[model samples]
Target: MANSTTAQALQNITGTIALVGAGKMGGALLTGWLDGGLDAKRVVVIEPAPSAEISALAAEGVALNPRQAATVDTLVIAVKPQSFRDTGAVVKPLVGASALVVSIMAGTTIASVREVFGGAVVRAMPNTPAAIGRGITVAVADDNVSAAQRATADALLRATGSVEWVDDEGLMDAVTAVSGSGPAYIFLLAEELARAGVAAGLPEALSAKLARETVAGAGELLHRSELPASTLRQNVTSPGGTTAAALAVLMGENGLQQIMTRAIAAATARSKELAK
Candidate 1:
């Protein structure tokens, strides 16, 4: 467990944290916590199936499968939705009223988490780039959450990326569609851009490299720049330049805006279906 001194660094949360699953997203959160100055030994990982991932967690100096279960202040659940039922029983005994649960399982609602663990629950959806601390995560918690729990969650999540909280759980599905599944959509754009470059007579490798780098660099610029995305885009577009020519097609009727809106709506609906 984390020592008293480390735990006391906060006003609300002041105990060890148990990570229920150390898979990709869970591992990412653990990495963030460790890198963000949380004591490695304070993390207790409870992964049963993947011994390899568990071994990795052990290498981080975290407690693996601790015998004592009820001592955790925060119990984070990052398991897949299909496995939640089986995993719930195993985790139930470890949860206490004082413990807060922050789950990253898609389509797993706070109600489901409370029913299983009977503790304050926060449901979140994070992207894959969180592996390197560049993802975005959106979370929502029930009334059971304390101010301390929310702060603790924000601190932990900020390690991986930016954190945004929604007032209504109903908006989580839109968040899931926009940010949770948004990365793949962006990657698809890069792929198509590269293909278009190749079609325009550029070498395949160079086209791919240029497309990837352009998107990555543009994203970095957006991160650092003070201007809004629309302003930055307008700054690059001229009255009769090549960019404007492309923008005309992209921004025209039956264009990217409508396409993206429909795609996000579809994804949002799927998320709601999964929750049901």
Candidate 2:
């Protein structure tokens, strides 16, 4: 599996790995790396206000805010987009000139990262499911990124989940809309499905439980099945059935597809704006 490969890759890395900002996503990546057999002794964490959980890693030999910067091989930037400039300035001196830089900050461009870090940069967007190692990430590297560095970046990103590489950076905006921001849309579907169930006279708690289970189960089925989503939906809907009645309303003109398209467009636009 990809996870086992990532573990082997982590074991192969000889140089020090430095992580900036140990927040939710960063914490998830750290957990993935450590869980994937990366040595704690080779890790260095740069966090101003470390949580108790992150601080605990220090006991395992991971460095925490050392006075001097070590020669880093890979530097991961996980700080908030708004705080990147300030954070980058502080961390820039900590990284070696040839260190491979991988960034997960939304809307942060490769050029932007290079301007601050001046390394072979890869910009990636990962969804919230990465917390559970089910997330998918899309990444693009600059011309300066060597093949080995790109492979290394892929291995590192694959620690949490699947990785997709794209030659065009322009697609990242749409990728962010579809994947990075996609989980929220699915969550909203679950929320609205429960609300609709309540409107149909189901008990509130029961409606919530049913909606949650249905969405989660359907997602799991989708993951396991090789069939297309449309085929799966067709398989579930019998002619003149209750699902058919609902589909009559949902598939009508100006329904879910139209709304979803508009939503994705809005998100993509917002991503482009934030990049500026």
Top lDDT prediction, candidate number: 2
- Write candidate 2's Cα lDDT for 66-103 as tens digits: 55346788999998999989988788887777889999
Model 1, CA-based lDDT = 0.84
**Residue runs of model 1 more than 4 Å from their true location after superposition:** 1-13, 50-54, 66-70
lDDT string for model 1 (1-276, tens) is 222332334223458888988888998888777766687777788887656655876776788875755567888888889898888888787778768889899988889888888888888889998998888899898998998888888777767877799889999999999999999998999999999999999999999999999999999999899999999999999989999999999999999999999999999999999993
Clashes of each: 0, 0
Give the distance in Å from residue 119's predicted Cα in candidate 2 to where it truly belongs: 0.6
Against the true structure, what is every candidate's RMSD? 3.4, 1.2
